[model samples]
Target: MNNRYSNKDVDVFAWFREASEKGNAYAQFNLALMYKRGKGVRRNDAAAFVWMRLSALQGIAFAQNHLGAMYYNGAGTKPDDAEAVFWFRMAARQGDASAQQNLGLMYRKGRGVPRNDETALTWFCRAAEQGVASAQALLGEAYAQGLGTKRNFQLALAWFRKAALQGDASAQLNLGLMYRRGHGVPQSDTQAVAWYRQAAAQGTAAAQRHLGVAYAEGRGVRVDLERAYSWLRRAAEQGDVDAQFNMGVMLSNGYGTHKDEALAFDWYQRAASSGHMLAQYNLGGMYAHGRGVRRDPAEALAWYRKAADQGAANAQFNVGVIYANGHGVPKDEACAVAWYRHAAEQGDASAQNNLGVMYANGQGVLHDDAEAVRWYRRAAEQGHPLAQYNLGGMYAGGRGVERDSVLSYMWISLAADAGDETACNNRKLIERKLTREEIGSAELMTRRWRDAHRTRTV
Candidate 1:
């Protein structure tokens, strides 16, 4: 059996006596903290204020900071931002790093003072230089966004690396992103995978999800769908929204394990209940499709509307599909176009491609080939396969772009190689007219693209 009395368990009168007689600053501070936390003693704001004031008078920087927190948080007392600032300044001037960083947050959030990004950055820099991992990450965020200083990816990466090395999970994730994106340094998928693994091992669900994605895509390590699916499951179990959504899909499709629609629906429900927009959209899909439950268009529409209200692009597109198909409701082309437009505004490649098709066919909106071409181009830039084929056809036929058989041949064949049936038929037609050399060049590019993107599992 363990017999221990926490500092919070001490009798107030006994502590006061010992503290007053011995002039024990640590005891005084601890007693003050107990009062602040209302442990063992009746909660009394005035008493906490008096005890912390006494300890602060003894040059206890910790006590000063505690007082600052109390004032800042308005715990058991009137909110006094100015007093909070004063106490924080005292402790910060004493070289207290926690106070410095917290004060910086206060200034940044305009809690105790006007929002002064510069002051926030300066204080964060000071604390970061003092070897505070939290402050280092905060400084990195500031530099990354140009909040107070000029945006500097290099500097942000440096600070994030330093903090990440010190076991800061958020910093680790940021550093991993920089490695994956080649923002400050040359892209190193290997390094990104390493950092993500470290953070994931520390129980970071976001890192687990990203690491799984890297594993699945073979960004650095050999692709392993089993490992990716397992990692995603771990993150999903911990309530990670993105992981939950992705895991639901994997379960529904039997990507790395046995197909289990019931499990997929359960996971989707868990994530959607937490206000995860994508999960909500996916839940709606399951209901609409009758994959795991009886088909219920009303329930699907309700979930789709929830996700759309939260500004989820995929949900906006799904809502449009539901309206157009009259899934469990009367068909409404006007509403379909409206939802499609919302998804299109958010740069959803599928929505852009579909919306363009809708316009061209006059299914839900005005027939306009030019508008169709514009939307298709937008989707093409995002690597949407269908849009690439559509753009190639437009170029070849002079429908919405300048006629260019050479470019059309390249794109149509490119799409065909990626499994587009229509593009393949057009490719067969173009192959006979083109010289062998032109065909070879297009073939090489298509092969290269396929080779670069094919996900081979380990």
Candidate 2:
């Protein structure tokens, strides 16, 4: 019924059969490709493998490379890394850039070859010099990271730039980072954004995430929160864990859109499920506050602990709170003190103040006035109002060191200035007992301290 065969309906099988009878390697390879891709032929891996082997044996470099790939990927035969390596090396020695790159990857990953970065670098250099984009990118990374090469930022930038100009998405992203960090290039947010835009347009998920952050912070362009949200959403949809966490933040804070606590929780959960530490911390807070889900203190503690184990200071502080408050757990002051100490050492102001209170009250740790003063001083210097009040009390009572009424008034005044109502009331009582000259000295001390260390809000 379909006898009107056009030029496209040539007898490919007969033509290939006649060429095969003549021992034509090119025709054999073409026939293999036809079978492999089911183009004008039935897709038969066994037939493809047979023809590919015949073509490869005739020393066709492309055929050799394809045969190696087929062996490596088990596309037309049983997977055989050793065979893949052998064929790759054969094709690489024949000056096939792609085969050289594949051989380098195999050596680097120790698949059917001893892991040798130097050998991998050598092969990658060969392929890169031939203008293979992926190999150029790999060579750039090797130089940048000193993997089988001297650390050379200039060379890294050069290779990355070459590959990026050739439309290599990964190289484009790395080039942007190098520009942003001023590595072998003048730090230029504008240049960074240009390269990031290129890679993001190419659908590189990491590049999209970086571009979103740049837009949000006005790094290279004017701050456009809506643009940031759009870019971040694109990356998040592609399963970029960090982008997912950022989406949660933007959604929760209503940045560039209406607030959606429920959606924020969902995004946070997605990232947290991927083992993102900050996402785990945010999820803990969501569970604690019942923002999108029902309040569950135990669930909050579980998430907090997961993040804490990864050295999240905020999560560590929350863990201390959970232990101290006995929220869905037995109240263990000692456990609370341990967790508080962990966070305090990491420069968490609230944790330092809480640790100071524990020492002052002999709650979990041994009662030591000096320890209390030390912790309180640490937090107070960071402009923590509660720490300022507690430190002032310690100074006034002479509990840790000699009584210093001037320092006590200075600290209390600072706490009051920061809007601590109790500090204001205490300052009023303390000022009545001071002479005019003493009050002047205290005020001068406060002014000097404030000038030296500007108070920063938590």
Candidate 3:
């Protein structure tokens, strides 16, 4: 590969043929380059392979490495991995850094050799010591992941920095992640963004997406929706699924660009087809509301089911609603209960409230006031307004537990504070039932509950 070729209109082909006939290895390599590149010769991979093999037999390390690559890639010959390993070993023994890195890759992948991380690490180290950028990146990953070495974040960071300084895009991206996560280095969003920008400029899709998110969220930089959209669009155009979903959200919400439901739906569809659960959920809502596409209950149900299967709580709740309303599917109270339970188990407050309603009315589950109160209390603790109002009614009527006016007032007042008009009206009526001391106790209880819930959320 390092051999020089004359391009001064000389008859280089004739000169190579005469020198090759004299058994000169360098001349054979030059002739092979001519055949490979069609320089002063017709392009012929077979001829190139033949001449390279001859030079490689003369112990020319670079020629041996080229021959190995040709065999490995089946260029001008049928693929022969074992033969490629043989040639790579020959060149690697002569201190060819490229061959050493290639051998390390083969050993790591167990291609034509037993998988041996230690051996792979040894070869990688050899190449890295010689300043091979790719080998340095691989060494960094190996150290970081504890592959054939003890996990060493500092060493990993050092190696990544070396490769990044040499313009290795992957290393730059990994270096950014390390800085973002404070692995071996102090957490610094500014440093992370700097490295991400370097990799993003080199067309690293993941880096572009991360950089876009950082810009949009004002992480280590001023919030710039336009810049975020630009970076995310670049990554999305490259078929990054997460970027596609993000682009859909931004477009739909008009975050950094004009609101474009049609474009948002397009991106959501692309991501949904790739099995992005959130995209499926969003696409289902779009279909349900006729936002960007024709309103179609059946299509909406189909998308919701896909997301629900992936454990999306909102999708599960939507599925329950569709079944209960008989929209696109047969009205099945049993199916509604099943979907609602699924969402409720995942802590969906709306689903919890709906489950309580179902239990209280015997619509889906057995009529059990105790179960209803239990579900209502779960939702109310999460600050669900409807559930708090419902719980207040239960406590006042003694439907599930003994009547406690103070508890009833506390629940209703909490709901009322959240702007529930019905609860606000009921609280005033309940206020007349309590003594002055009871009202004070109820108010104190509501404040304590609010503080506890706020702390839990934070």
TM-score of 3: 0.84
Q: Estimate, for each residue in 282-380, the C-alpha lDDT of model 1 and write its tens digit.
A: 899889889787789999999999999999998999889888889878999878888988999899888898888887778878888899899887886
With a 3 Å backbone cut-off (N, CA, C), the pairs that clash in candidate 1 are none
Model 2 regions more than 4 Å off: 1-28, 41-58, 74-83, 455-457
Q: Which of the numbered candidates is closest to the native, going by highest TM-score?
A: 2
Per-residue lDDT of model 2, residues 413-439, tens digit only? 999999999999999999998999999
Query: Whole-model lDDT for model 1 versus the true structure?
Result: 0.84
Error of 1 at 454 (Å): 16
- Candidate 1 lDDT at 319 equals 89
Which ten contiguous residues of candidate 1 have the minimum total lDDT?
1-10
Higher-TM-score candidate among 2 and 3?
A: 2
All candidates' TM-scores? Answer: 0.70, 0.90, 0.84
Give lDDT: candidate 2, residue 122: 100
